[model samples]
Target chain A: MIDRLAVIGVGLIGGSLARALRAAGQVGEIIGCGRSQENLELALELGVIDRYAQDPAIAVRDADIVFLAVPMGAMRELLASIGPHLATNALVTDGGSVKNSIVADARVAFGCMPPWFVPGHPIAGTERSGVGASFPELFRQRRVILTPLPETDPKATARVRAMWQATGAEVSEMTVAHHDEVLAATSHLPHMLAFGLVDALTRMDCSDEIFRYAAGGFRDFTRIASSNPVMWRDICIANRDSLSAMLARFSTEMSDLAASIRDADGEHLLEVFARAKAARDGFVDGGKSLAEHN
Target chain B: MIDRLAVIGVGLIGGSLARALRAAGQVGEIIGCGRSQENLELALELGVIDRYAQDPAIAVRDADIVFLAVPMGAMRELLASIGPHLATNALVTDGGSVKNSIVADARVAFGCMPPWFVPGHPIAGTERSGVGASFPELFRQRRVILTPLPETDPKATARVRAMWQATGAEVSEMTVAHHDEVLAATSHLPHMLAFGLVDALTRMDCSDEIFRYAAGGFRDFTRIASSNPVMWRDICIANRDSLSAMLARFSTEMSDLAASIRDADGEHLLEVFARAKAARDGFVDGGKSLAEHN
Candidate 1:
């Protein structure tokens, strides 16, 4: 019945998943694993999991499911150490932002494509990270994109989809490569722009005064730039190719728009602004939650 | 004491100021004037003003204080109509976003700076507009930037500054040119970029699917893009030169950033990202209300 579950790297995503599973009564036992002893203690204290272990191998010893919630860069080392320890019937998944690299690692570590390895990315998070920000309803009304590899088993994919659906998330599937590309366009490139904008503003020496006067416009434009540097650093590295391509395309568009504005072409500027406004409305119309951000 | 105050264009900013003034017992009677009969009726219904007049000239006939809360484009026409009727000693102010253009309008309409005509920009707003969104605390803890022209009366400026302080806002003084430039860099250009980015995304054939998958970053980046189109359009035109300059600078930076990423220059990308992250932190450190967004 896939009752017992052990989530490695019990940070915000993993801990929150544990909490949701318990609240929904979807699993029998929840064991939390992380490199940080303090985080493990906090997860247990928060009642996100019933037990904990330090080693990834020890944590997944008898579990029916294991989630690699660690950073993408750390996934290879983790999968290598724990792959042989996982029961053949156990489902292995991850909450990593990038799926392709991790999918490759899993294949290499397990000596073949693991039928039960279903990679997923939950489109939900907050600027605050680690176990401190974990909550059961974090995924409520959120989208969870599943990018199962070609060799993934249909039954395993269904199980993973069902698990996320139980958390009140809508599940959809895409190929790993497509997921990386689409996300780079929609998510990663925006973060890069935000980070780049803020950096440019900071180096301008006018930041202190500029920030003081930052009203609604600046607040929203720069909000996502306040995310954890280490986490974002890893994301940028892991999804370099897609991010690079998206940034190039975005820069081209930005330059074109800039040229139109510089020429005082109000009609052109209005057309661009109108298009953006329509797109934003379409996003709201798509029934996505504006809550839960980073 | 400013017993009877006349609010021009009884919309969000004007109505909100009237409400706040009434709540603070700072005014004995609040009279609202607007071209729209329905707006006048709505303003009265919402208690945004104690009374309403169809003509601005009649509304300010006996008013001790007059606040122009119309769009920048409408400012000149409004001042030209109401200038001769303003009570001789009345203190006049405005809630316009762009100050440079308004200053010029005030100078031409009033003929040798009116004793009470003060240019002010309250750096506070919501995504919603109109009389319905007006609230008493809209200015609390918000910045109120005042741009006093070369010939502005010192007494008039002080009176205007005191009025803003009563609404619980911190006041700063700057030149009209500088005010427009600073705001263009911080507010206007950012909005334009948001609108442009969203527009670019929307114009793409894959907009529907892309929007459906938009997560935190895209949503935040595009939120300001969804702000009142009319108001933003006016802002872009009124502050075009400064906005153009800022846009050009930002585009250059974005281009450089894009090139850095495309070249797989991780070190350069990380540096840029780090600077942006720091500036955003500094903005938060400067106490911009990011939490209030959601």
Candidate 2:
């Protein structure tokens, strides 16, 4: 059980982690900190946190555990500010979408890769954001991926895993590069496609009619386009390499599809479509392992 | 009420139309014709059709309305065979995704554009297809766009519109070119993207881990990728010009996005993302007109 938990940036992930630990009766005191006083107060009223601290340094000063849940853009500054005040033994982790960049931020801030810092991410969310949208059950049955540096203390990693497991999340460990690469394919690329598609349509001369005649299929395809743009912008900049690589690969295949259509190659079109349907069906029905966890 | 309604294809759209008309007491008889005898038998058992016919010519022989729900690739053959058998006054409409090509098919089959033929497409469906996957309420509150040739009889178009309206669909009319262009951007483009995205990932070395780590967003984005491959293939080829054009425009934008990501131009990414979110929000919250029918 956590003696004192410091949650910096009381947003969806931060607030939910606190709520889950409180609901599971596994935490003593939760200190919420953010730039937004209103959001911190809402977290306190919602019982998502025990008290509020406007200063990140103050928030992490006496905590046994500290969670960084702000957007990717804020991670570097927060890490720097809290580094000087953190309890020597506090296990530090984060819910940042991009692990490699934030791990670099930790390395720079702490003047080295701290053994107490365990970088992690929970693959659970809705379109909504903010503390008001958080719930204690947000992480239940979800997957939390941790990418701990080799020099990290095993006990620190265990504590982070135990915290997530307490919230009913299945925790898995991977190398930082692998976590970034896998998520770039699974999550980041899809969001970029959705955002790019919508942005492209809006730029067209027929934009008005395009959205007007859009069917439910179009809506579902663009659902992720409605996601927070600033956060996604940060994500784009955070994981630039893998995302650009995936985009180039996808663009090549897209050009092939366009050529196939131009040539009216029914056989080629059918083969690609059939293959896609098979892979998507397999993934949806049960990706050898997807069905087990999700 | 119609004396007899002949529905060729007998899949999701065709079966649902028959069930809706029957439920509303607007259709006197529904004769389902398809390549699959088992599917037709299931439709009859489910009361989606009053009877079944193996040949399209025999099916449309005595019908007042002929609804062609076959894939775009099969439209030419069905039009040719049914041309000699259809009643001169039959108001023939279709559920094919492409309008311009189907009109071409009708012209080729009849040696001219028939006044009795009115092409229509209902913008409603689930990922599931086949007669068994159909339901009567599928078109309720959904939009159906009809495109009629200039030489087409107004009464024929009106009858087709009334037929769809009776099934709780909101019907609108536009020229064949407009219908093809609008649908290519809204429906066809999104389907192609989903199919292409999934197909590209499957070709990657990390395809196994890609599908395994996929989250709910990836699943939702690829939902349409699981649609009937043959039908999508037909749609892609049938609307080749417009679909290819849209793909080119979107691909250019995708390249720009990739360059911005590589350059780490946060401003470009932020602006594009914000604009897309705004437009998507407007459409989803009710595009100037997307709000009404859907």
Q: After aligning candidate 1 to the native by TM-score, how far in Å is the CA of B34 from where it should be?
A: 2.6
Give TM-score values for chain A, per-prediction.
Answer: 0.95, 0.95
Local accuracy of candidate 1 as per-residue lDDT tens digits, B115-213: 678889999887667898899999888889998876778999998888887887889998888788888878887776677667766666676777778
The residue-by-residue lDDT of candidate 2 on B44-76, one tens digit each, is 999899898998889998899999999999999
Please report, in order, the local distance difference test score of every candidate based on alpha carbons: 0.81, 0.89
The clash count for each model shown is 6, 0
lDDT, model 2, position A128:
69
Instruction: Show where candidate 1 strays beyond 4 Å.
Output: A108-112, A288-294, B110-112, B288-294
At residue B212, candidate 2 shows an lDDT of 70
Q: Score every model by TM-score.
A: 0.92, 0.97
Q: In model 2, what is the error at residue B292, expressed in angstroms?
A: 6.7
Best by lDDT: 2
